[model samples]
Target: MKTLIFKTASGYLLPLLVLFSVFILLRGHYLPGGGFVGGLIASIAFVIHSFANGLEETKHLIKMHPGFLMPVGLLLAILAGASPLFIGETFMTGLWFENPVPVIGMVGSALFFDLGVYLVVIGVTLTIIFTISETL
Candidate 1:
């Protein structure tokens, strides 16, 4: 690994993949793609970078352990699902805002739940990959 071509390509690929993942996530509500797919794509980007560069360098680039994301994501999801309860709606009910957000459009609890799923998937995938790589 760490070949010149791979390293060079990965540098460009990382950002592109991340951006595409976000695109997938954002459009998932109406489209086929969703948080799970987006998260997988995002994790693949980092995995490619790790393979091209060293694991240490990839970890450095990430700046924090992936495990930390899990709880935060779970909390966000739980909150999203429970938010409707306070307004006398059922738990996990879809709650939409009056106005759509600029880029994401149609702000709702579903999107937040999807985002939470995205983060959890990314965290779990990265943690497993990193741990396996470290062991090997």
Candidate 2:
């Protein structure tokens, strides 16, 4: 069928797109492409996959319902924000530590916060998209 051909042809593209989304997510703290953009990019990829295959297959590919992404991402963000409180500093303090590994160099609570945001975006986007797609 037409769907089978389309899915097979485009199946290889999903991984590449997801990887690029991750790259954007990681570099976002320093530059323009943060969670919002990265999450959007990832959602787009999933959307493509969903269209090519179907809602159920896309869900199976991720092995999780879209609803799960929001809470976990929220938890990560909250924990990152609360980290400073545990260290006797102000809430959501930007605490930076020099990593022994270069490239990554300095790590901070801000990075974790950013990561949490990234997850939230992905979760919420997927939740909405999948819900809509499933309904139709």
lDDT values for all models: 0.94, 0.81
The C-alpha TM-scores of every prediction are: 0.97, 0.87
Q: Give per-residue CA lDDT, model 1, range 38-98, as digits (tens).
A: 9999999999999999899999999999999898888988999999999999999999999
Positional deviation of 18 in candidate 2, in angstroms?
Answer: 0.9
RMSD (CA, angstroms), candidate 1: 0.8
Error of 1 at 68 (Å): 0.4
Instruction: Summing lDDT over every window of 10 consecutive residues in candidate 2, give the lowest-scoring window.
Output: 98-107
In candidate 2, position 122 carries an lDDT of 82
Candidate 1 Cα errors over 4 Å, as ranges: none
TM-score of 2: 0.87
- Cα lDDT tens digits, model 2, 112-131, are 88788888888888889888
Candidate 1, overall lDDT? Answer: 0.94
After superposition, the stretches of candidate 2 with alpha carbons farther than 4 Å from their true spots are 1-5, 100-105
